[model samples]
Target: MAELKEIVSTLDAELDIKSFGKDSSFSRFIPRVYEPLKFDWQTAFEKDFVELFNGLMLKGNSTVGKVFLAVFPTDKVLERFIEESNSGDLLFMHHPLLMECGDPKGKWGQGFVPIKEKYIKQMKEKNLSVYTCHIPLDCHKQLGTNIAMAKKLNAQILVDDTLNAKNEYVLYCNIEKTNTANLISVLENIFEIPYVDFEGKKLEDIQRIAIVAGCGDVVDWMKEAEENGVQAYITGEIHCHIDNDYGKQKYNQIMEYASNTSMSLIGVSHSASEYLVHKTLMKDLFEKNFNVETVLIPQEKWWL
Candidate 1:
C-alpha cells in the first residue's frame, strides 16, 4: 500500500506540475448545478498540485491499496471505478471534469461538465480519492502523451526539448521510410481505433512527422510543422467539429491550412491519444514506485 500523500508529493515533483501555466479550463464552464464544495477550485488547489485545479481534487483516505488511472472522470468510468475499487483506491486522471471532446463520427460534446453531486457524495462515502494532472503530463519528456505516441510508433525524435530547446509539447520526429497508408495502419493498431481523421496529401514517402496528442487542430502548430519540413502531423482531433461559431471558424482555418499544406493531418481521437500515457508509462510509474496494482479505466467509446 502507498500513502496518498506520498504518491501526490512524488508525482507533483517528478512531473513538475507547477511549471506549466493555466490549466483552469474548468473555472468558467462549471456545471450550472455544481455541488458547492466547502472549498472552491482556487482554495482546493492552494498548496500541492497548484496548477489552479490540477492535483488531489478529493481526499478519501490517507493510503491507497490500488490506483485506477483514467483519461477522464466520465460518469461511466467513475461508476465502474466505484464498483470495482476498494474504499481507499485512487482515481488518477488527466482531467477532473468530464470534457466532452465531441465524437468523431457523431455530434459535438457538451464540454467541461462537472461531476454530478450524487457522484461526489458517493465517492466521499466510499472513501475513494481523486487526483488530476493535465498540462504537466502532456509536456513531460519521457512520459508525455506525445512522447508516448512517438515511442510506440518507434519514430526517431528529430526535434524536442531534450535535443533542441525549440519544441516542447509537440514532437517533430523522423520515421523510417513509409507512406501515409502504412503509417495510418500502424497508428490505428497502436491506439486501437477504427478510423483516423486524415487530411492533406496522402503521399508515398513520409520521412519526418509532427505529433500532438490531443485537440491538434491548431493552425499555427501545423504551420510550424510545415516550416520545419514535417511530412505528417499526428494528433487526437484534426477537426473538433464543435457546434459553435468559434469551433466552425477554427475548423475552417484548420481545413484550409491542411488543404494548402503538404503535411498530412491524422487525428487519433482525444481520449485514446492521452490514454496511452496512463496505459504504459503512468501505469509503470505507479506499479514501480507504489508497488500497487493499477487499473486503467479506458473510455468506453473512443469516438464519443
Candidate 2:
C-alpha cells in the first residue's frame, strides 16, 4: 500500500494541477449548504480552485490500499465504492460531483449534483479518501480523455497538449480516411453505445478530426476546430442535454454552429467519452506503477 499523500502528490505532479488554473462549477450553487459542516474534504481542495474545486478533496487515511477510478462520484457509484472498498481506499475521479449531463433518449437531467450527505458521512467514517482531477485528466498526453479516444480509434495524434497548452483539452488527430456514417459506426462500437448523436457533413475523406472529450458544445472551440481544417469533431456531448438555463443556451448556440459548419459533429455521451482514460491510462497509473489494486466503477447509465 502507498501513502495517500504519495498517491495524491503523484497525481498533482503528473497532471501539474496548479499550472492549469482550471475551475469547476461543481460546488458553485450549494456553497452555503456544505459550508456549515466545514468538512475537510470541502476545505482541503487546492486554494487556486477557490478552496473547494480540485485535487484531493478529502484525506481519509494515511495509506491507500486500493484506488477506485471513475468519471464522477454519482450516488450509485459512491454506494458501490463504499460497499466494496476497504478503509483507506482512495477514490480518484474526473469530477467531484456528478455532472448529470442527461440522456437524450431518456429522462433529461439537471446539471451538477453533490454526493448525498449521508454517503459523505459514511465515507468519512470508513476513512475513504476522494481526489478529483478534471481538466488535468483532459489535458494529459497519454492519459487524457481526448487522447484515449484518439488512441482507441487507432488514429495518430497530430497536435497534442504540449503543442497547444492553450487548447490542451482539444486534440487534432489523423485517421484513415472514412465517411461520416462509417466513422459514427466506429465511435458507437468503441464507446459501446447503441447510437451516436451527430450532425453535419458525411464526408468521405475525413482523415483529420478534432476531439474534445467531455463537452464540445462551446462555439469558440468549435470555431477553432473549424479553423484547423478538420473534417469532423468528436466529443462526449455535442449539445448538452442538461435541463438548465446554461444548458439550453449552450445547446442552442452549438446546434446553430454545427448546422452551418461543414465538419461532422459526433456526440458519444459525456461519461463514455471520459471512461476510456480510466481503462487505458489511469488503470496503468495505479495498478502498474503505484502497485495498488484498482476497481473501476463505470457509470450505470452514462447518458443521464
Candidate 3:
C-alpha cells in the first residue's frame, strides 16, 4: 500500500500548489478559506490539504491502497467507492462534500442540511478518505477543465488566461471550418452527453470560439469572448432554470447580448465537460507516477 501523504505530495508537486495565489478575492469565496500557517515548507505541506478543505477528513488516514477520482461528492459516488475499494482507499474530487454553507435563501439547503451522517458513518467504517481540489485543478495548465475541453475540440489556442477573475482558465481558440450544429454534435460525442443547450447565431456562422468548462456562464467571460472577436462561446451550464423566471430572464439577456454581437452560446452538462480532466488527463497522471490503482467514477448526469 502506498502512503496517502506520499501520493498527495506527488500530486501537490505536479500541480505546483506552492505557486497558487491565496490572496485573490475569488479565493476568499471558496468553501474554506484559510490563513497560511507560519511554518516551514514541510509543516505547511502537512497542513495544506486538510486546511484547504476546512479540516474535513471524512475518514481514514495515512496508507491508501487505491484512489478514485470524481467531479463531485455525491452519495451514489461515495457508495460506489466503498463497494469498489478495499479498506483505506481515497476518494479525490473537484468539489467538496458541502457545496454551499447553510443559507436559508439558498436553493439547496433551504436552511442547513448537514453532510449526511450516514454517509460519514459509512465512510468511516469503510476506511475511506476524501480530498478535494477545486480552483487549483481548474487552473492547472495541462489537466485543467478548460484546457482539456479545448484540446478535445481540436481548437487552436488564441488566448490563455485566468478567466474573468475566477482563477480558472478560459481559452479562446479557432476551430477548423465547422458549423454550429456539427460543433454541438462533436461536443456531445466528446462529453458523452445526450443534448446541448444553445442560443444565438446560425450553424454556418461559428469559427472562432471561447471555452470555459464547468459553470462558466458569467457575463464577464462572455463579454471577454465578444471583445476578443470570438463568434462562439462554449461552456458547461448556463443559468436557464425552467421554473425560475428570474433565471430565465437573465439567460434571455445573455442571449440578447449574444444576438446583438453575432455570437453563439453552446452549453454542455457541467459534470460531463469537467469529467474529461479526471477520466483522460488525471488518469494518465496517476498511471505514470503512482503504483496504486486509480479509477474514474463519473458523476451522474443531472439532466435526462
Best by TM-score: 1
Model 2 TM-score, all chains together: 0.90
Instruction: Report the CA-based lDDT of candidate 3 relative to the real structure.
Output: 0.66
lDDT of 1 at 151: 88
Question: Residue by residue across 46-135, what tens digits does model 2's lDDT show?
Answer: 454455366887668888888998997788899999999888999889887777888877767788676777898898899899888887
CA lDDT of each prediction against the hidden true structure = 0.81, 0.81, 0.66
Query: Which of candidates 2 and 3 reaches a greater lDDT?
Result: 2
Candidate 3 residues 3-26, lDDT tens each? 877777777676665566452323
Give the RMSD in angstroms, all C-alphas superposed, for model 1: 2.9
Alpha-carbon error at 63 in model 1, in Å?
A: 1.7
Q: List the residue pairs that clash in candidate 2.
A: none
Off by over 4 Å in 1: 21-24, 27-51, 160-167
**TM-score to native of every candidate shown:** 0.91, 0.90, 0.79
Report lDDT (Cα) of residue 290, candidate 2. 81
lDDT per residue (tens digit) for residues 172-204 in model 1 = 889899999999999999999999888898989
- In Å, residue 108's CA in model 3 sits off its true spot by 10
lDDT of 2: 0.81
In the predicted model 3, the residue pairs found to clash are none
